[model samples]
Target chain A: MHIPDGFINVPTVVVTSAVSAGAIAYGVSRANRRLGEKHVPLMGVMAAFIFAAQMLNFPVAGGTSGHVLGAALAAILLGPWVGVLIMACVFIVQCLIFQDGGLTALGANILNMGIIACFVGYYLYQGVVSFWGERRRSQLVAAFLGAWLSIVAAAAATAIELAVSGTSPLAVALPAMAGVHVLIGIGEGLVTAAVISLVMTTRADLLQLERV
Target chain B: MRYSFLDQFSDLDSFIHRLDPRTKLVSCLAFILAIVLTPPGRWQVFLGYFSLLLILIIISKVPVFYVLKRSLVILPFVVLVSLFIPFFKEGEVAGSYNLWLWQVSVTYTGLAILGNVVTKAWLCVLGLILLSATTGITDLLKGLEGLGIPRVIVLILSFMYRYIFVVVDEAMWMRQAWHSRSFGNKGLRQIKTLGNIIGSLFVRSYERGERVYVAMLARGFDGKVRTLHSLTFRKADFYCGGLWFILLVVTGVFLW
Candidate 1:
């Protein structure tokens, strides 16, 4: 899911860089207001956790390995603004220190994995949980759908980036990426659900925040 | 649950590690752009790129073996996909083979593409290892926030970092439980036990998420999220960042 540098082309980087920049600016402003004093260091630690998890990829089909995205988990646990910020931090570190993703494609990766996954996944999770009465079972379903959609959304966004960069024809990149990613999404959903369940049981108090 | 793996190298004072996360982030991005944008046939440029990253790796003081091992983890996936290129990539056939009724051909062009993919990917990974080894993950996220990264993504990363150790601990405990109940990996029943362990892990994680959420809310988490501090830019950040960016551009232009 972390597209290394040069996978997409030049023009796509330009566009995505701008879009990602805009989103980050807004997310930071929002997070400033929402986060309490304690959240500063806490968020930093949480960011570190996502970085580690992303590094832990389990083998999946089609010769690719998938890992937890942590988007839905972030948003449902810490609110959407913080969720997006956490992913941005992970993307930046992965590129600079770990090189898991491309520098030029940072914007694209943020948009795909950061924006789409965190914000989109959080809202969807909230919607489902609220709709189903916000019980334990509802939380599981919300985590599933939220995690599943984030992966698929990221796949769609990457396909568009490939198309814009003119890497392979859209005809090739779109379906190929989505097809493989759908299988990947199943893994993401399960992992997200597991993490959410773990937090729910040990510190159910922490999750009560989502309900409020 | 020890989770020091991410920042273990961050505290070692070094020049490369001292640069602002945003600066290093951009430089690496440019390096990747240069590699990915180069024509596939430019084998020399790939060599040049590899040498460049290798030089940085040495300067950063991270162990050669560690970087090599980390980068190699990506090889399996790359090889899995690229291996088939010789058979599927459309071009002049290098050779024909038969397995009973089935016939297939391998093409030189496909092999070239495979080589191209592997080299580019490897070069990119080397650069990342240098970055990860030099910067603490926490500082890196702050730098990202300073550079206008969205809050939600940053939040997601934060939780993942804090809890990965906990998750690993849980896994360890589950393994111990299984080991205690069984004599060894001696039978098919062990496999079933493993499956049960995985299933229970999933359920446990799902429940844990709720508790974390409640903890967050107790701290006054409105739907809106906020951060407590900021990443301040320093003079070294500018000079080092500018120098690296210029060098990358110069090298990339020459490659072009």
Candidate 2:
């Protein structure tokens, strides 16, 4: 979730911003190595795709709709570094251009949505796929688990940040944030799994090339 | 199809719109920092911050109703996130509730904090809306670059701004195709169709990326992106920054 400004205190903001800056710097260098002159523009396109995909709402059960968060999807489709970079880019644009997120809390948003979601979701997907043997079914299962867990994890991290900021005690914030997100995670899992399955069926080669 | 851009009013001529984007960008950040850093329950300070943003909204001539409406998007989320704070935060119990196995008590201090958080977030969003509504995304990115953000990130954002609508249109076409083909699909079938749309969208995007790269290469593209430095700080920018600084200092003094 996008943490608006004032939700977390000033010290939390400073610390998270520093961490986000480091992670983004590392992500950019890593992406540079992965992407050559011929592939430089691909990152921007992928970021755009993620942003557009996020705007598309699909029907979940009970007539409710949810859109793609695209972190797990990005990491699985691209490498983790590229995934993180794309996510960071998207968040920055959302904050500065769209005002969808707060400028002061941009670091917290990136940390939660970009770094944590991409890395944890990517590694978890890889672990599940490897352990279960990569197949169409395994791809679906891994995508589902990765997306689901990543969202819950980000929510948990946000709760901790809030607690640390003394906005709310961890005991209260953790369960509340986690409970809502656990349901949100299911939506995330379904969308991520469906897309990954379709991609696996069509452009299996792309996934193979990007697989870490 | 025509899509309305996010910064539709950015091209409008106004004092706020004409100011250097870098100045606006930094000032906006400063405004937000000032809002967030204010101690909770500082009602006067919050009001001061709100008035400052309201003045900017008026000067920007971006239509106060539009900014207010857009800023309301954050309210649901803020309420959802902080709704339980009063109940869970342990302090002087303002009220107590008994619901089966749980006893929930809300504290006045917690309620005050929650109110403070919501007000601060709303004000911060208003400030940001003022910034973005006045400055184009391209100029915003340029301002960020001039402020020392890395080049790679800026390039990525510039392209994202340019092509986000393109991808959206592509996704919209796919949705139209799906809606037109499947009359009454629901449940798993609907998700599957949506998945197909997203999957195909990704492939299309990937191919487009390749095509764009090749097109760039055809023009003797290099890794480094260069842009014209057309942004110049005016006396107004300095005055604007100074005015904000003075207002913020006054608020800080009031806090003290």
Candidate 3:
């Protein structure tokens, strides 16, 4: 879902870059103010973990495999702001070092994957957990739905950007992007739920760590 | 154990390799931005950009095969996203096909746009490959830091770089263990097992982070990260960067 450079127009790039930059700057200041010294290493390590975890692909269907985008998982594990930071870092590294995404499209990628995914997944999870009571089952259910929707939401956002850039029309891009991601989102949901359950069983304290 | 995959050719000596990372980073961004902002169907401008990248690839001395292979990674995605454009776009019909109960037509404008998108994406990818293949990851991060990227981000990137391989190795081991224990299990069962592995990895990484933080505190690490070698832009940076920028501007003006 990483958008390449030419797929987006200049206005879209500039606007998205401005928004992402502002959000990241806010996140950095929040990290500094709220968590102080500990969050630096913690966020760093979590970013690395997310990056590496993405490499661990699981079999989906038809002999194909998919990996966790880790935005929802990160947001569930860390708070949304820190999740945003972690994901932005991951996107930047992927773009610069791995060339997995485009340089000019970095802002759009970050806005979709970093901010929108994390925020949507996180708030949805929080809302579900709060509404359903934070039992293990509810948390797992929340994780699943939150993760599933996050991917779809990011995909939709990507499609909208593509349409707005005139790369693809909304009539085509919307349904196509969202339709494919719906399945991918299921895999993301399952992995997210399983991972949450595992963490709940093994190291629940990590989940309880102070959120910044 | 082999972590060279990240920056395999960065150690090679060449003018591109030796140029300040900041210069390379800025040049790369400029190159891609120029490529992306250029109006579509400017075949000459696109060719000029490609030639510029080709010249850099040659100068960098990284294997041509490696650069080509790396740049091709974007093709499947580009194709997947834009493949239907030719059919969906409204213009002069290039061809029409009757499939089952429906008729589909491809448009000349749509095909042209699709081709233009692919070309732009490919040129941008080539520019990125040149930047990444020549500069060490460390130097790139340092350059980003030098360019006024936040200290927090730079630190996070550095720590991530240091430990990604370690985490990846652990993940591989866990996958190996799972493969040994499971016997052709597919579906939810497989996803559950993978989830457990991810959770365990997360826990281990979190603890490692704590340990690292404690170690840093013990070694007098404040909230600030300090590096000994700072990046400096020498005479070569200005000359090369200026020439490249001028070339890009000239191409944009004359070609446009």
Candidate 4:
């Protein structure tokens, strides 16, 4: 869901860019608290790992393939602050280095894929896992639902932005974006659950931050 | 990950490559803003935008075909998002189709808007591709930092660029191992193995993070990250940036 330039109007870009910058600033301070002297390398490495993992495509349904969005996975593995940082880094690299997204739309992309996905996914997972009791099974279910909902939420936000910009009317853009993302979310859910379950089974120690 | 995939042509010597990355970055942002602000159905303006980009592509020495092919990658996504607008938007009916128990009408106005959105998106992508194709990621990150983006964000981006390929190589090795062990099974079983692969990759990455930290410490890395500033704005940057700005303003004014 990398929204290209011209997908949203100039006013929308300005507003979202301001909001995104504020959110990122808050996330940075929060992340700084957790990132001590020793944690710097881990933070950097984790960001790189997320970037690398995104390049790995998995078979979804039919012959189609989907890559991990890694927002929920990052939040579950690291704290939400670090999760936001990682996603933001990935987005910046994609925009500047790869041209996968537009520079003018960077803040919007960060807000949608980084902030929205990371925060929403993290909180929803906490809520679900708490309700279900923190077992392996509960964590897996929570991961699946959290990942799926995060995609839906980001997609919906993108739709709203498009509508607000008058790029497309709400009636037309909302359902269209929401519909496509619902399917994408299924893949997101499955990958999220599978990775979490596998980690829980194999190297549970690596999920030390999940408790935080 | 193909590490060079993003900036494969960045090292090539050209006027565009030689300019300060900050200038290129700002000009790119300006170009996109101009494209977005242009009113719909101004076909002349769109042509002007495209022609301007074509000239830049020539000056940059990036192959026209490479840019064209790269720009097309955004079309499927553009189409997917905008295709239904023609059906749902109400206007003078261009065509009507009866399906099952309902009728759907396409509007001329909607089609025109759709075309405008696609064209605008394509032009914006071209600008982005040009910016990325000529500038290295490290320089771009430095440019971003110089432009007053927070240091923390810049540091994170630099780390991402430096180590992304190493992690990708690890992933490729794991996938190779998986393929060697398993074959002809494209079903549920493969997904489970895929999960195992991802889990293992994460574990390895986490451990490597610790090792990398140790190595940094050994090399006298403090908690604070620092980089030597190597970028300087030359007179050529001003000349090129001024010329581009004037072109954008001239094209923009011709519209009214």
Candidate 5:
């Protein structure tokens, strides 16, 4: 999902980088509009929380552990733009100081993990919850679907990027990436659902703020 | 309920750790680009790149032991995916072996490819560990927002970050509770207990999400995102970001 440097072709890197940059720039501006002065501190605290949570790796079938991408989780909690920003920060820091992702490909990484995951996951979640007609079970279903689709959507988006860049054949890129991620999405849904539930049961009030 | 895992190392004071995330992000991007752009099989360039990474790791003040441990964690995953590469990566035969009524062959190309994959992955992870360790999650979010990430995405991540520890704690508590109530040989019974716990956890998480949404609605969250930009770039941001890119270019152009 991180999409390191070498695997992708040069043209894809350049184009995705440009597109990613535009999206991130737009995201920050949008975040600025949404978050007020008071909400900043709260948002910061939550950001820290997400960073920490991402470290906990849930075991997968092949003995490889996959951690939560947290795009959907952030969307459900803070809203999507902020969620993208949060991940962007994490990825940025990871790339610069840690070199977890390629710098030239930063655009693609953010677009895939931050923008697509955050927005897609949240709307799906919000919609599913809304459709369930105020049922608690509806939230779970929405969360499950939102999370599952968010991951797949990100995979699909990456496949498109890979195709555009001609990094790998789309047929190979789409299924290969999506297939493994689909399995990973299961963990994503479960973890996302579990976290949202804990927050609601405990300090549920904090999940919302009075918008002026 | 709060946990940043190994990323908590960012708490330490260091010049590299304090630099803006964009600077760091761009610099690392440059580093990775340089590495990837370089054609494989240049052993010296790889060595230089590794050395460069080592220097950054040292400057970041992350415990070498911890970094090694963290890097090793990914080794298993990488090995699993790439293990087949060596077996299936047809090339000039380096060695052949017969065992268990099957003949196995090793190729130099396979070995080379395996090394390439492993090295690239290691360098990438090294960069991530440094970035995560030096920068606080909160500030990192601000940096990303400032850099042009989408808000809807930001919100989703913020929630995940906030509630992840809480969720894990819940699981731990539930496990403890399960242990206290049951007193049988730990096998299928334990598995069954685990299943029950997961089901219950799922229910609770679902309920919480609803309450959270209701809370969201109460706060004027109309399925729309809003926020103010707080991460104003300082002079240091420019200095570092610029210097890093320059360094990356130099390395890419000269070394490779």
Candidate 6:
């Protein structure tokens, strides 16, 4: 869901950039107050981990594979605010270093993959876990659903941005982007659930870390 | 192990590479904005932007083929998203075809938009390639910090660049180990194994982060990051940056 330049117009870029910048600023301040000196190396390493994890692809079907977006997993492990910062860092590095995303479209890409994905996944996972009383099975199921919905939501947001930009009509971009992501989201969900389960078994204390 | 792949051509000496990274960074953004903000269907403007990037690439001493190959990274995505625009757009139909139970038609407007999008995206990508290829990653991060991006963000970026390869190597070794141990099992079991790999990676990275923090503290580290060298803007930066800005304005105004 990395929207390259020209896929959206100038106004869309301006609006999304403003929104993402505000969210990131708020996240940064919150993290500064809450985390102090420890957050720097930790967040940086987390961002690197997410970036490296994205490169590790798992086979999805016949001759096709998908990789984890890592937003939900990040949020599930860390808090939403730190998740935002980590994802934004990953997106920035990807855009500047690798050109995996366009410079002009950086705002929209961060808005979709960083902010939207993290918040949606985090809130959904929290809601599910809270409602289900945080049993191991419930937490795993919540993680799966949260990861799945996060991808779909991010894809939907991209489609909406494209439609508003006059690049494609909503009727077409909406279903197409969301439909493809639904399958990809399944892979994301499975990986997230398994990873959480692994964490739960090994370092359960990590899961109990205070969400910033 | 090949860590320099991210900015492979940045070490080469040239006018483009020698200019302040801030200069190259601003110029690249200006070029991309010009390409993206141009009105659709303006082939002349698009061609002008393409040639501008080509000249820069030539000056930077980066291989044209390398830039072209890197630019193609966006092609599959562009094609995937815009492939249906030609069918869904409402305009004077250029051609009509019958496929099973449905009649599909391609419109000239749709084709034109598709071409414009692909062209614009290509130009912007080439501009980015020019910036990244000419500027080393460390220099680029320093440039970003010089440009008044937040200090913590810059620090995070530097750390990410420093350790991304380390984590990547670890992940690759784990993948090799997995392949060696497991049969070609497919389905939930495979996903579970992959998850274990990722989970283990996260744990290792997190612990390494703690170790690094402790190491930094041992060296009398504060929250502030200090670098040995600082960037200085030269006369060439002003001349080149001014020239690039003027060219962008002239092209945007005259062509529009």
True contacts kept of each: 0.20, 0.65, 0.73, 0.61, 0.14, 0.66
TM-score of chain A of 6: 0.98
What are the per-model C-alpha RMSD values against the true structure?
6.3, 1.7, 1.2, 1.9, 7.4, 1.2
For candidate 6, give the lDDT of residue B123.
Answer: 84
Residue-level lDDT tens digits of model 1 in A27-130: 66666556544454455556655544554544454675555777766777777777777777777666665566666668888889888888778889988987
Assess each prediction's global lDDT (C-alpha) against the native. Answer: 0.68, 0.83, 0.89, 0.82, 0.65, 0.88
Model 1: C-alpha RMSD to truth? Answer: 6.3
Off by over 4 Å in 2: A61-63, B1-3, B98-101
Model 3 agreement with the true structure over A28-104: per-residue lDDT tens digits: 99988998888888888888899989988877668877899999999999889999999999999899988888988
Candidate 6 per-residue C-alpha lDDT over B91-113 given as tens digits, one digit per residue, 9 for 90 to 100: 89999889898788889888887
B40-67 in candidate 3: lDDT tens per residue? Answer: 8899999887887888899889998998
Each model's TM-score? Answer: 0.67, 0.96, 0.98, 0.95, 0.62, 0.98
* TM-score of candidate 2 versus the correct structure, residues matched by position: 0.96
Give lDDT: candidate 6, residue A17: 92
**Against the correct fold, how does model 1 do in TM-score?**
0.67
TM-score of chain B of each: 0.85, 0.93, 0.95, 0.93, 0.87, 0.95
Q: Which wins on TM-score, candidate 3 or candidate 4?
A: 3
Choose the strongest candidate by lDDT.
3
TM-score of 6: 0.98
Candidate 3 off by > 4 Å: none
**DockQ, Cα level, model 1:** 0.18
DockQ category of candidate 5: incorrect
lDDT of 4 by residue, B101-126 (tens): 86878888778877888888889889
> What clash pairs does model 6 have?
none
